[model samples]
Target: MNVSPPPPVGRCLDMCPMRECKEREQQGRLFRFETLVGEGNWARGRCKMRSLPLADPSKTVKEYSRPAAGKKLSSPCDLRPPSVLLKTVNYLLMEVWDHVNERDLASLAEAYIFVFDRLRAVRQDLTVQRIQGRLGAFVLEGSLGFLLCAPYLVRDLPSDSYDEVLHAKQVRDCFADLMECYGMDPKCPREAEFQALLLLYDLGNMDTINRALKLPRGVGDSPQVQIALAVNRAYLEGNWVRLFRLVHQLDCLQACSFYRHLPNARDNALRVLTHAYSSRNCRFPLDLLVVLLAIDTTGMASEMCRRRGLAVISGEKQSVVFFKASFKDSGPECAGREYILIETKRGDFTWAEIMMGENEGEFMRPKTN
Candidate 1:
């Protein structure tokens, strides 16, 4: 006798013969993938199967739709221990970030992207796993240090580079996240430093400086905080000499964070100086400009002067001849060299040492002759 055809597969787990039936004798077959109802084709839903009797293949298949009670899913990253996550963050800061340089802009950008992604992953893990106490604080501090270095790395890159804006925005957003972390813990010793960095990051914004001033009594008194306030005040007053002087006092990371403001500050200073030293025959020593603008070399200072339509006379001492009428307002050009202050200070400590707060007092002290 002819047998009736088997029933068409339905949405229920038991209705689909393709699914492995748990009730059947162990065949060790793998479960087939299935798309659940209302979920698009791309959505995956796993199911435990039950077999029906061979005598009746047409019966409606039983549903095993609900997930097992009390079962939970977690990402592998979320499962990592606090120590492991902290180590990963430290690795990125100490090892991976050390080699990121400006030799190849494309490669530099790629390296930054890679390191930033890993750091972000670790940070997310710390948050999701609810890591707290000293370990969490250390990890957060390390991540903040990494964020603070972003501007220094990209400082020399041409502003028109395709990834420039993307890099800037990402760094700002990540910095804000780190600040929020410290904001939750008022007593963290590093919190004052990060708050000061926020002020330095936007020196032109009076609101940021004002908010910083209103912090708990002692925060405004911290060395970094005092320096950041001074820098902001000097910037508002067009006092480039005092501004760069205060910048020289900042620690390596804080100076790096403040580098972004250099171009605007320099531009504004040169504009004001144009009118102040207006005589066509009056000569301003390029060496003095170097000191005033915190420029690394007189050559770079001369080039910046030339760009702004000043006349440079070369001899025993290079000097710029300022004529208010000839001074071209060429907005702000990135003219300064890599911060020698950071380079010299960085040479004294390894990235690991910096992260550990080793010799912190010496590190933060203004370099003296």
Candidate 2:
């Protein structure tokens, strides 16, 4: 009788993605065997131990006796293979991966449309639910990366680049379709899509973000949408103090079920602000609320109050804490534009004080007694 010894186990290379293979190797090695023609229990459960390798125990051999078990079998499980188009899409994704890995933004921007087209093909094939389910994950990941890079890419283009463009509608339509996929699978383990939209809001691409925000979801109003709106308002109003102030407030915003209601509101707000900041949209609107939502500033909140000459007055429900912000000039620009921050006590409200100053170095004078 001849038997083959078990295979020698070897350490796996680092960063290998073959999880199942690694798991299988955790058990003892697999082996094979050959039976003699005059086997004692050929048709029976009886078995016999074959002759072990007679060579030196420590010596490696060119050949060995056959063992009991046969060759290891292929894994029974495999991911559903993608269609030809999808396989091509995967290849393109690999290219994008390489381009990104190489830090070649120019090449990536050039090949981006090919990736987009392939994704569109996959979207059309979604008439088959399994294909949709399988491909949606890949599509979402790629879409998120693309959306995240959109602001950078768009800003990089020449100002007149879009003047004669006819493809904007097509691109927008594709983006909408991709967003619909993300919406249908809200809990699909793809939070990046939601994160990307938040970035888009700060990137000045409100048109796409607004459309995505309108989709029905488990929650009526996404905190991301609210934060985006706040930042947008700050930009529109040209209030730099308010915008930067919002950045400070966002830093203090805890993910209270009573407030943000989302699990990762802080990170989400940070992403939005970072994206908006990266867009170089320095024009800030002075809306305190918008500034509060855009940046994560905390210590300045109290200083903001003192600078406005606003007294806390009272903490009662009707006589809520109130503070007003106004400039010394009080010109037409400063007339109705100045803001009042107030908290109510028992439903009646009173002015606490007034605040002024866009520059942090200046002092806020309280109202004269």
Candidate 3:
């Protein structure tokens, strides 16, 4: 039996986009600055940056522009398949996969959109969900890769090359805008859609999630929406027990699409949990809280505890204690601690935040001081 290897890990996935940029550069002038927003247009005269290989360009363009005379799609929703459409889909996906593997960002983005549109058009009538699932995964992965890489691509482009930036920005906006729509469109995975976008938030450390820009205008009322918002709340507030629970508890985020990055999310929550418990006067029996931290082994907990300058006693039921060193008191004014690390201020909420809701009635109330 042949089994495929697992997909890349979180850090590897985070860096994959950047690696694609480097790989594209290494391909050495294959892609010209000349834009090809259309599939067949690449063969046209705009090859100023570099002339590309053209094995019968005219024939390729003509054949690409329209299906062969004998083989029209035959109907708006064609399902009369020896599963012939499956073959077409596979060919397109192969082109996409090849472009992606070659790190040809321009070609990959164009082919991704084309394949997605074709898949969606026929997905409704397909007899097998396997193709749909594969395409869905591809779309998710491609969109995520480009989203991570776009800002870097734009930054690397020369300041004088407005055209290249425009092209890169178009590819970035295509999916970001689609996601913006998906987050609001009632026909989607519903309230959980924004949650998936937040998974991108964790992966990319994007400000759009923190500032709440990624959320759609129609969200904010549902339990899942509230729960998703609360996940961020728990994270920001150092409530790791709750944050771990929320990130792993996908009942509210059933259709979240971000993948291979989830283990990173869990690790992050545990790290934060351990960090918090390692704070001053925060001791607790390891057995009592390890499950909430998603800790599976006593050995792992003990190692982490020792590394973080904590003591772990060996026993059938074990316990770990950490000590956070205290700084010297400054003066009489410093007799008691003053709250200075405020991440949010009371009465600082804006009505603009309500745009995340359908109407003001569905808006979350602002926290008061």
Candidate 4:
């Protein structure tokens, strides 16, 4: 019996740079792989080889590998079988998020990053393999959607260092892929919720508005979509009162989507209120400010006023004295703080409820007084 040579060792399998060269070669862009070590294992040991274009063999280009000195290797999760990847995703969503609240801020931040990376890797794998059907939908809709909404739900997580815009774009891209491959039903309430989220992300963009209009008939009429459109109108009209009222009507995930726009809304509302309530003799009640601005607390509302060049009157009736001349238009002061309405609404639903879109009727409607 002849023994075959041991399979070449120390080669990068997943995310190999030479994979691109092989693909190019298949497309008629011929390249020759040159081995730099013993046995000339050009086929498998890409880390020890370089590729040269056959048309210009004298001009060689080095194909960097994952195992190159000082380079970090790809995550082990990248090489996991599809079944294992699915189980890992399920574990993170079912086991981890259910008890995420118990972790301290430091641990929460670390956990968030770890979970995000794992989910991202899984998504990439599923996408690259063109996986479709039930498995793809589960990962895309449940795991991926949770990732999009998480930044808002989990507060103060040292996110300042990340590229938020790039992150949003990546999530949007994955969602688009999901819609294209799995086909979202207009009748599905979850679809409507996601459509509403996409619209809310950029309310002022006409392109976004047109996209919402183009959705199948009932989608635009869904409670979530209707609320999002109303919020858009309120935002454009600078009607802060109506805006916050509509915001209160949104479910937890929708509210999380709307969180990014809060600072601008608050700033604009304060400017208008300062002028409307401008008086040396009269003061605006902090309690009313809480309602009008949808702020979580009287203390936070008072602090916001103080930061904006208004005076907080401390007495039996806490009030803010806003002089139009004294009020400064310093841009949005509180960007990431939580609101009372959102917090209360958040408790009304669980992680699974939001992910799976269960209890549709209850989650869709705001709690009635």
Q: Could you tell me how far off, in angstroms, the CA of residue 124 lies in candidate 1 after the best superposition?
A: 3.2
Q: What is the lDDT of residue 251 in candidate 4?
A: 76
User: Looking at model 1, how many pairs of residues clash?
Assistant: 0
Candidate that beats the other on TM-score, 3 or 4, i.e. the better one: 4
Which tens-of-lDDT digit does each residue in 176-279 have in candidate 2?
55456565566644443344344333334566446545655643255654554564566455544454444333311111101211112322333343335433
- Writing each residue's lDDT as its tens digit, candidate 4 over 155-271 gives 565555344665677677766766664353323335676778777777766787777877776677888888898889898888999999988888777777777788888889999
Model 3 off-target regions past 4 Å?
1-175, 180-195, 199-218, 251-283, 326-369
* Residue-by-residue lDDT tens digits, candidate 3, 90-187: 43333333334224545544444444444333332232222223323323333333333333223323344324444445444434544444544444
Candidate 2: deviation at residue 295, Å?
Answer: 15
Q: CA lDDT, every prediction?
A: 0.63, 0.33, 0.39, 0.64
Best by lDDT: 4
TM-score of 3: 0.37
lDDT of 3: 0.39
- Ranking the candidates on lDDT from highest down gives 4, 1, 3, 2
* Candidates 1 and 4 compared by lDDT, better number: 4
Candidate achieving higher TM-score, 2 or 4? 4
Candidate 1 clashes between residue pairs 3 or more apart in a chain or in different chains: none
